[model samples]
Target: MNDYYGSVPLEEYEQILSNREYWDNISGEWEMCSKMEDKLVRLGTFVQRGGDLNRVIALYAGGREYTYRVTIQHCIERYLEALTNKRVDNLKLRLFKLEKEEAVKLLSEMLKVSIGVDFRYDKYTSRQVSFGVLDTRWLDAEGILTAIEQEHRQAHHDESVEEVRKRAHTWIGDSWW
Candidate 1:
């Protein structure tokens, strides 16, 4: 199994970029291992990451998919900044835009909070892990969210629909601009 993404220092990314096997070889290059669908099977496919001129990676390293995905969901932006050798919200750009450091202060401050969230669906346990923190959201895909209208789940939490909705509301609201 591979170690978690971001577990290594910045040098590793530079090394990966230099390797011929890991690239999609488009205009610039995309990391073949970073694509989500069919991963290594589509090593040269055009599935995207980064955002603009940037690209992506896809991998098929055995048993590492889960860790890579979870870490990606949390840290892709920062990871892209490193891989592309660009600051996510580059302070220099901000400084130039305003011709001073004052305009960049808030943007700089914004990067300080490092938080991550993941919702893992454990099919074996039939439990839905939400928020990467709370083991909540018992996960009713159908209309039977309540116990009164429920099926037998292998492993489910007893959180009420109202509570789950409230948590969902807070998370969504907090995420909004």
Candidate 2:
């Protein structure tokens, strides 16, 4: 076994990414590990630190074949790593299976929360006002906004399914614009 706190082999990471089931299982495992770490800390046991980007990537690639929690875990880990450059050392991750109605309700709530600001007409948008917080790929504000402006003009609509993308891009371009 490797002496590193968290080190995943490249081939293992690829295998996990390909196997969804395997991925999900490991996602659950990470979640459990995280929770256990929390408990340990509470009980004065040494806190089990979270995996770094390399570890997450390794796990993701490891279980690429199966449809499992690993996929979501990988995505969440990647998102956090990309955005914060820190491991998930002290966060709680959960997986919930919702009914159709519940899913719709959650979706509706998400839409409302994510698009609460109209970046097109607004002069100042808060960082919390857009989906860029969720996906760090939108860090290039100007580029993202340019793309949004083009898309909006093409669609000739104030809002579309691409609204969040536009807002994120716009915010990226000019936080105070």
Q: Best candidate, TM-score-wise? A: 2
**How far does residue 114 in candidate 2 sit from its true spot (Å)?**
24
- List candidate 2 stretches off by more than 4 Å: 1-27, 36-59, 73-177
The TM-score between candidate 1 and the true structure equals 0.19
In model 1, which range of ten residues has the least summed lDDT? 44-53
User: How many angstroms is residue 61 displaced in model 1 relative to the true structure, after the best TM-score fit?
Assistant: 24
Candidate 1, residues 34-145, lDDT tens digits: the string is 5422222121111111111111222322234343323321132333233224564542322222211222122222222212345677698798654311111332212221
List candidate 1 segments past 4 Å from native: 1-30, 35-114, 130-177
lDDT (CA) per prediction: 0.28, 0.31
Model 1 Cα displacement at 173 (Å)? 41
- Whole-model alpha-carbon lDDT for candidate 1: 0.28
Task: Write candidate 2's Cα lDDT for 19-51 as tens digits.
Answer: 233223345554554342222111111011221
